[model samples]
Structures are given as C-alpha cells and as structure tokens.
Target chain A: MSPSPEILTPERILEATEDVLRRYGPTKATVVDVARALGVSHGSVYRHFRTKAALREAVTARWLGRTEELLGELSEEPAKTAEEKLRQWLAVLFEAKRHKAGDDPELFATYGVLIQEASGVVDEHLLVLIGQLAAIIGEGVRSGQFAARDPLAAARAVFDATARFHDPVYAPQWERPEIDDEFRAVCELLLRGLRA
Target chain B: MSPSPEILTPERILEATEDVLRRYGPTKATVVDVARALGVSHGSVYRHFRTKAALREAVTARWLGRTEELLGELSEEPAKTAEEKLRQWLAVLFEAKRHKAGDDPELFATYGVLIQEASGVVDEHLLVLIGQLAAIIGEGVRSGQFAARDPLAAARAVFDATARFHDPVYAPQWERPEIDDEFRAVCELLLRGLRA
Candidate 1:
C-alpha cells in the first residue's frame, strides 16, 4: 500500500464515480475506472456498496435527493395558502426538470440510459415525490381548500395529470414556445378541479 | 415490361407493408423488404409514396386513423350528458391504450419505434384526439355544465393531465394493479374540476 492512500470512504467513491460517469458516460463507465479516479482498488469501493448496481443506485438517489430536498421545503412551508403552494410547487418542479434536461444534456442522457438499470431507486424516488404532493393536498383538505376524499389519491392524480410538463418522455416539447402557457393552463384547470 | 405483375395498388402495398412491419419490426422493415413482401420492385413502392419516409408516414397515419375514428363516435354523441360522455370517453381512451400496450406488445413496440421515424404523424394524431376532446368540452361549456373559459385550451389541459394513462412512456406502469384505481381517481378529480 502506498504510504497513507487517501481514506476510502463511500462519499469519496461516489464523487469519483460521478466524475468518471461524466467523462465516460453511463454505458462505458466502470467501477474500476471509479476506483482509479479515487486512487483505490475496486475491492475498496465494493466494501461500502455490495454491487455496481448498488453504487449506481446510491448515485442516482443522491442526484434525485437534491430535487426532493428543494421540494420538501415547499411541502412543509406553513405560510402560503394551499393554492399558492400547489402552484409554486408545480412550477418549481417543472423548472427543475427543465434545468436537468437542458443544463447538462450529456449528464441527463447518462441518467436516462442508466435509470433503467438502476432499478428501485427511481421508483422509490417517485414514491417520495408523490408523498410530498400528498402532504400538501392533505393540508389543503384539512384547511377546507380542497374537497378530495383522499389526499394521497388526490396528490397522485395531480402528479399524473401534469406528467407532460415533467415527464422525461415529453422533454422535447419543453423547448416549444408555448410550453409555459400550456403548463399554466393545465395548472389552472387542475386548481379549479381541486378547489373545495 | 411484364405482362401482369399482379396489378399492384397503393392499398395492397400498404397492407403488405403492415405485414412486413409486423414480421420484421420497425427497425428491420425497409422499403425493399416491403416491396419484396408485395412481390414488386422497390421502384414500384417509390412510385406511390415518393420515399421510404413517406411510406412509413402513410402506414403510421393509417394505424392512428383507426383510433381517431373510434374516439370520433364518442365526441359526436348527442344523447349523453357532458359528464357521462367525458367519463365514458376517458375510460374508453384508457382501455384502448391498455389494449395497444398489452394485447400485442411486439406490435405496440414496433409502432413505438416507427413513430419516431414517421415525422409529424404522431403530432397530427395528437391534434385530432385533442380536437375530439375539445368537441366534448365545447358542448359542456355551451350547455353550462362546465365552466371552462376556452374549450380548446381545457381539452389540451385535460389531455396533458391524462398523459400517464395513455402515454407510451408510462406503458409499464399500466400493468400495476393499482393503475385502474389511480386512473378512476384522476378522472373523478378532473370531473369535479370541470363541473360548473
């Protein structure tokens, strides 16, 4: 062992892996390359994560975590009326997705390619997001701002209803001049639909 | 020139091209293969469609036309209330999508692959479906059963809102046991939203 090789922590491995992924893309990026970037052996990296799939999951989860944290603030905010909160939440979500799809298209494409292979991380991320929407709707129902029988179900409905604005499959349409107008129109209809 | 080359027609060529697409799939099915399937020269196919792209566009449009015709009946139905028409319309749309996604996954996938290559056929198809939706919403507004200011905009909003139920990207989620429940719940909320 070289005298005091930099400490092998999961955090360091993840950062290195993300860097390697940025360079080689999802398809060509390998655990060994990540290990090389970290100046450690592949076995050292695997000690923290059982498999490459696990490592990928951790990385994706990390990326999605950022978005969730940002939204979590809105979900927990106590001041805004539910209508205002819902509108802000959705606009922020759409903007966040647009930035992800536009800012670093290469990284976004890498995530798109790797997402299928990452397995439950994406599903879990979705559940977390839907849960956030549920919390807001639950509050809306409690305050008599919405008339839904079930906040969880209502949250899911709103989420599904706005899929075109946020779903990666429709990302190409985001560049159209009328996307914002369409988003607002949908939001208006949904807001009207959800009002008590 | 041959005495009789089976008297090729555009309809017959389209029928054979559909068969070839079903057999070889979108990626592998070419103009030459379609021509070979028709027992004619590629030049003969070109004479009708001008280019291979034109042939692909024609085949995709024909397939989409079937769906448009199916929904057109519901859009024009004058007997039912707007609410019932909307409910029936959504259910029928969901069921149709489910059948397309579930009945013959290979054929569905072939269509999915070919769709990207078919240019504006999918967009035109979307406009047709949205127009059907607008017709129903317009009647609702005129009857004072719905409060939407712009029926066309409301139709688009509703269409985008229901993307999860019909969008091919979410096709895998259609298999979930809870999908029907989720769809109905969304429909209920949307109906409530649209009510005057």
Candidate 2:
C-alpha cells in the first residue's frame, strides 16, 4: 500500500470515499471504509466532512460539478454564435452523461443512490445547469437570433425538451443506434423554435 | 367479510391486487393479500393470473390503461386542429398524471414500484402514447400545419420536451404553483417549433 499522506484533506477523503463506494456500493459503503482506504482514522475524515452524509453530499456535488465546469466553458464562448454554442452545449452534456453511465456503470449506479440521498445537491446542480442554458439563451435573444421574452423559462423548456438525451433515467436507452438520430431531431426542432 | 365471488376472473383479481398494493405497497403486497381482499382462495386468484408476477403486471397495465383511455379520446377528436389537439393533448396528459399522483399518493407510490417491475407494460404504454402523438403530428404535417419530416421523431421529441410536466420522476414538482406557467411556456415553444 502507498504511504498515507501527511496531510488529510477533504479532497483526499472525498477521493477515498468514491473508491470505497465503488468497492462496496452505496448501501454497504461506510465512512470507516473511506478512512481505511485513505489510511487515516475515521475521526480525521469526520474532522473534514463533519458527518458521513456531508461527505457523500460533497462527493455528489464534485461529480456533478465536473459536468458544469465542462459546459461552463462552452456557455462562455463569446466567439461562437449562441445558437451554435447552445447546440454544442447540449451535445456535450449528453455525451458526458452517457460516458459516465457507460464507462463506469458501478460508480454510476453508486451515484444514482447517492443522488437520491443528496437531492439538495442535485437540485443545486440542476439550477447551475439551467443558469448556464439561460446565459446562452439570453445571448441569443439579445442578438435577435431567438424570440424568447423570458430567457430563463426558455432555457428550462429546452432543458426539459432534451431530457431523454441526457437524463440518467433514460441512460439505458442512450446506447441505442437510433438515439443519435433522436438527439439530432430534437436539436433541429429546438433550433427551429429558437430562430427569430 | 363480503361473500366470495362465485367466479374469479383476471379482471377481478387485478382489481383486488390494486387494492392490496395500495394498502401494503409493492414490496409487501402479495397475491395472498389480493385473495384475502377479494374474499377468495389464493388458488382462485392464481388460477386466473397464473403467477404473482402476472397479477402485478396486470395491475400495472390496468393502472396505465386508465390514462391511455383518457388520452385516447383526445387523440381521436377529428374536429380539433392538429395544433389545438396537440396543445390540449399535452395539457390533458399533464393534468391526468398530476391528478393520479395527487389524488391518491399511496396508490401512486404503489404503482411507481409496480411500473419498474412491469417495464414491458410501461414500454407498451409509452409506445401507445408516442403513437398517438405521431398520428396527430402526421396529420399536422399533411395539412401544412407542421414542418416535421419525421412525425414520429417529432412526436418523441415533443414527449421528451414536455416530460417534466408528465413524468413521474418530476411529479413532485407538478404541484408547484408556477407549473402551469412553465407548462404553457413549453407548449408555446414546441407549437412554434412545429409551425410550418
């Protein structure tokens, strides 16, 4: 085993917790296992997280944040037209989620349970995503590319409209050959709707 | 204790099974409870259902069929324009689901579990709903009302777009005060998208 780090940080604890969760799944995973993985006392882990629930919530937030960070860059690209940015933004989001659900299904399943336990985190993540969409839509409206009086509402509608392409519950269907065609059709419809 | 029915039918068994599920939930609900509720022998219930899984599946189909029957009427209305029909159809679906979720939450929760266990039933129900949407969309396309090349694809997109208003996972949000406004805004956007 690698030597325990001299510093025990929340990030270290969270990283270890993810490993533990993957090893044990959600129901059986424990703070003690995370501590063991980190080669630290449970007290040290608790010192950073305060509680196991807090630790799990943080991990979930971290997982969701990665998607936000990736999409945030696309949303902020002033060089690209808002319409193009919006299209790429959605495509990227769908691909990221598909990869997470496909490349590491065990961890994906673990996060599914953790997400239920961390609804507040998930809610916050959703708001962040909607905010990203709203920003892109607001740009479109200001540029006279879209005809939305309420950019935020329009953004939400777009989000909901494309949910089958990105939502975790529909992950099982994402791998189907027809999903790409479906995604393109949805994007085309939304783009048409947005055209002023 | 009412007198047991002289003859047991699959319909009766399904009805009793729904009551049992409502009372005990999916996990604790059993074929025996259905039999007890109907004041009939377990053998009588089994003889009609063939197995407990079949009984639960039938109950799920029965629950879903109620919504189908309600929406089926809207899809068949010839006098209404396809756009108007599409608008009303989505509105009615959202209302129907919201009522089912709100009117009897216990039964709704019971059916949520039953649905997962009866995915084939759920899949068939989805196809029926999408088919209805496709027919309306095809009508729209033929009449020069909508611009979709693939009515079925457009129908699926519309379904996914409006999911938050009807999907069970988002049922909790359906009761929020602003949901009507949200639903209207989404419908407006989609209606615009379909405009030729």
Candidate 3:
C-alpha cells in the first residue's frame, strides 16, 4: 500500500519556498527545489500548490502576511496627527526594510522583483496594507490636521519614498537616520500643503 | 567585387527605426525589419549600427531628444513662484504624454517596457530624462522659490506621479483634461509638502 503523505503546514511550505526563491530567483525556483528543501516529495508540494504561478502567489502572500505582522500593531494605537502618524508609519516601514537587510538580502530582493512584476494585477491584500496609510491620511484630512487633498495620492507618495529603502542601490548609500528625518519633514510639508 | 555601400545619415536611420518600433515592439523590430522599412539591405543597417541593442538605444535617444527640447525651453523661462513652476512643469509633462497618446502608441509602450527592463543597467539613459526633472527641483530649492528639502526625493515623487499616465491599464481610461488637472493639483500638493 502507498504510504500516507507527510503533513506539512502551509507556513512551513511557504518558508521553504521563500528560501528556495532567495537561493534561486523566480525563474529557477521549481517545485522540485522546494520539495528538496522541505524534505518532502514533489507531490506534497503540488498538493499545496497546483502550479508554479500559484506557488509564486502563495510566496508573495506569505511575505505580505509577515509584513502585516510587523505593521499591523501600529494602526491599533490611538489615532494621532497626520505628521505624527506619517513619521511613525514611515519608521515602521523602514524598520522592516532594515530587518530584512540584516536577515535576508536575497529574499528582500526577490520580494521586490515579485511586487514590481505583480503591480498591475491588483492584489487585494496588498491594497489592504496600503489602506492603513490611506486611513491615516484620511483622518488627517478630516481632522484638518492635513490640508484638504487626495488621500490616495498622498499615501502613495509617502509609500513610494519609504519603499525606496528596499532598493539596494539607493538604500545603502542613504543614511537611515537622515531618511527618517526627511520622511518627517516631507510628510509635514505635504500636510501643510494640504491644509484647507 | 561587392557593390560600393551607400551611406545613410544617422538622422535618417533613427527615423526608420522609430517607425519600425512604432509598428512592432523592440523584440520584433530587428535591424532587418528596420532596413526593410528604409528600403535598404540589412548589411547597410549593420554598417550604421553594430547591433539591435545599439539601434534600440538610438530610438530611445531620439525620444528623449524631443522631451529634452521641451524641458530646455521650460527651464529657461522664469517662474515667479515655486508653485507656478511646479504646475507649469506638470502641464508640460502631461501634454507630452497626451501628444504621444495621439501619435505613436506602440513606441510609447515599447519605450516603457525597455526602460523598465533596463532599470538597473548602468548604461541606461533613462536617468538623463529624470535628471532634468531633478535639476529643475534643485534649482527651485536653491533659488528659495521652493521649500528647503531633498530635491532628489521630491523629484522622485513627481516622476512616480507622472507614471500614472504611462500605466497601460489606466491609459485608455485617462481623460486628458482630468489628467492635466490632476497632475496640476498633485504638483501643487507636492510643492506644499516640500515647503520649509
């Protein structure tokens, strides 16, 4: 009789997949490679993900989930002024980049490549991540703490600045302390610009 | 003996390549294809450009030359205030996108694809286009017409915002008037955010 398959949690499989992606980029990260990493057969990997595309999506979802675990705690605090929220939020995002810089350079690069590749597909979960920043901007605008303006564009701009931290070319050259300070200054400038 | 080769002007070759790129994407727009478009042999095309890559670069150079022509004129004109300069500059960029939308759809799309693909390459000339925008921001900041800030970051924000026009998903949906107004508003908001 065929042996029953070993049970591998989705999280464990995802971790292995991320490791595989880090070692070999998206083009080379195959089910066989992932299965080898997990000490499981290819069928086990296939059970969790039907195709490579599905696997890639799951890997990205896993990364976002971790980002949420890192960022989700901030939004729970009492609401604050736009400047305060923007400063704290940019710090949170930058810290995540720093954390990855020390822990997993390849994975960080892989995540960026994946995000850029999937940007047009409109991942709902990623939007939810962005929505937290958007909510802060909305609160600022409504409270008259920020100038009346388009929250979505403002949030996107802030996100873009912070996201640059993930770029190896720019991030290494940049001083984090300076970038954080500039983040505050830039956010304040935007809020003042938006003032009704 | 081989027939004596006829020489074509660099200007004439670039024009033919642009026409070919507009008709077909970079991958399909081979030297042979360009030569056929110009009614010359592929060998003649090779005599002018060593490879397809060189030809593609020339095509991109031609596109940038036109953009630079407009930017050069705008830079020389004095704006009384940072806000006015920012708004007028946004209008100029959006107007260029609008003009391209009418004239050469494939060329614009291919340009975007090539730029994105060549993003990290040192020889990529996309930076020259962005540098012009950065120079304007730096000049504004130095002149004290703009806020004391990181001109590079501010420039990056403006470029990111302008990219909305280049998005394939949103391009068809874009209303010229709405984009022009939106760009103007966004630039005003950014300038406000950048202020001292």
Greater DockQ among 2 and 3 belongs to: 2
Going through the candidates in order, their DockQ values are 0.85, 0.68, 0.22
Model 2 segments more than 4 A misplaced: A1-5, B1-5
Query: Each model's C-alpha lDDT?
Result: 0.88, 0.87, 0.66
- What's each prediction's TM-score? 0.95, 0.93, 0.69
Deviation in angstroms for B1 in model 2?
A: 21
Q: How well does candidate 3 score on lDDT at residue B27? A: 76
Model 1 Cα lDDT, one tens digit per residue, B1-196: 8877698888888999999999998888888998888877899898899888888888899999998899888867678999899888889988998998899999999888778887589989999999888889899999999989889998898888998998777888899999999999888888888999
Candidate 2: fraction of native contacts reproduced: 0.65
lDDT of 2 by residue, A81-137 (tens): 989999999999999999999999988888989998998999899999999999999
Q: For residues A1-196, could you state the per-residue lDDT of candidate 3 as single tens digits? A: 6564566977778888888888898668888999999898989888888887777777776666777666767766785566677667767776676777657666666776776555443356556667887887788778877655678766655554344443343445345466555455445545566665
Error of 2 at B68 (Å): 1.4
Instruction: Show the colliding residue pairs in model 3.
Output: A147-A194, A147-A195, A148-A194, A189-B193, A190-B193
User: What CA RMSD would candidate 2 show?
Assistant: 2.7
Model 1: lDDT to the true structure? 0.88
RMSD of each: 2.7, 2.7, 6.1
Residue-pair clashes per candidate, as listed? 1, 1, 5
lDDT of 2 at B158: 90
